[model samples]
Target chain A: MSILFDIAITAFLIISGVFGLVGSYGLIKLPDPMSRLHAPTKATTLGVGGVLIASMLHAIAVEGQVSLHELLITLFLLITAPITANFIAKAHLHRHVERDQLPDAAPDDCWAVHDIEPFQAGAEPSTETTK
Target chain B: MIEYAIYFAFGCFSLGLLMNLWQIVFASGVGDRVLALDTMVINMIALLVLFGLMAGTEMFFEAAMIIAMLGFVSTVAYARFMLRGNIIE
Candidate 1:
């Protein structure tokens, strides 16, 4: 039983560490900003998640105690990571990407980031659309 | 075995943090820099957890959690600033 627990914990640590390294490597190695954005958001989140899981397992199997705080961190990270990525993508689109560079959105609509006045109070929505 | 694994994990994540630093320094755009900073925050959290494991203490979990929350908020603030030229409105 002890050996099995050791194996599991070791595997989790190594795997998560590899993932974390790969994610960070991708940040520097990927050629473009948007492609670079893809790296840390998905890969690093998984990496942290793996570490948290390993920590939980170590607390339970080895230390003979329950530790649920890791769960809270994992849940919070999972919820927030995508939102962070989306905001970054939107910022990139707004500042760096050209309207013509993106593939078309639905025929009459444009990308939300490109919309001229999405939140203006009581203003009429534009009838014209990007083509 | 577990000891060796912990050491390896520490090396990996520390190296990862260095790579994030390189990205932050050399990145061509604001978004990339923000992303690197966010990644660095995550690497720091992983290091904190590993330290907790090594020391056999739960004290670091709260610190890790707080860092996670703060990192997310700061990343969003950076992105918002980039998007609209301001953070909160």
Candidate 2:
């Protein structure tokens, strides 16, 4: 039974890793930066997080011990991936793409103003930034 | 079984590293590259967890905690720069 459980967990990790691979492929093949962000950010985060969980489960299952280290790492990855992605996207927009160059879509709808509310004043801008 | 799982972990880590390397070399935008860097950091965390399993010790967890915190703070820092062009170092 324990061996069966081990096999199941290993299978789970591999499948999830395949998903991560697909996401990374999307990263390489995608045409635009924004679109590239979409694949890895959403899929890879979940993919890597899934495998991490599997690793944690496998350890606990084999040793009859619980580990919180992987769990905490997963939580941090989930929380941080979006943030770094957001920074990079915004930087690309500001540095390379022009506002006038942007599609005439309602800019407000295009940019999700979460951290600093672009164009707003005194919004307690995020403190964790570096270029 | 764990051996097979370790193999899978190696595959995932290698795949992730390759993708990140591609981004570093070929990606066109700063944001995309930065996102790739974060992904790399996550991969490193995954590697550490695997090491914990191999060693049968919980110390790797501490390293994960510190790295996670670093990832978080760096994301915040990058975000700050993106928004305002300055970070409150």
Clashing pairs in 1: none
The residue pairs found clashing in candidate 2 are A88-B31, A128-B76, A128-B77, A129-B76, A129-B77, A129-B80, A130-B77
Q: Say which docking band candidate 1 falls in.
A: medium
Q: DockQ of every model listed? A: 0.71, 0.57
Mind giving the per-residue lDDT tens digits that candidate 1 earns over B3-89? Answer: 999999999999999999988888888888999999999999999999999999999999999999999999988988788665554
What stretches of model 1 exceed 4 Å from their correct place? A117-131
User: Per-residue lDDT tens digits of candidate 2, residues A1-83?
Assistant: 88777877777677767767777777788887778778877877777676777767876787778767677677777777777
lDDT of model 1, residue A118: 36
Best by lDDT: 1
Q: In model 1, what is the error at residue A70, expressed in angstroms?
A: 0.7
lDDT of 1 at B29: 82
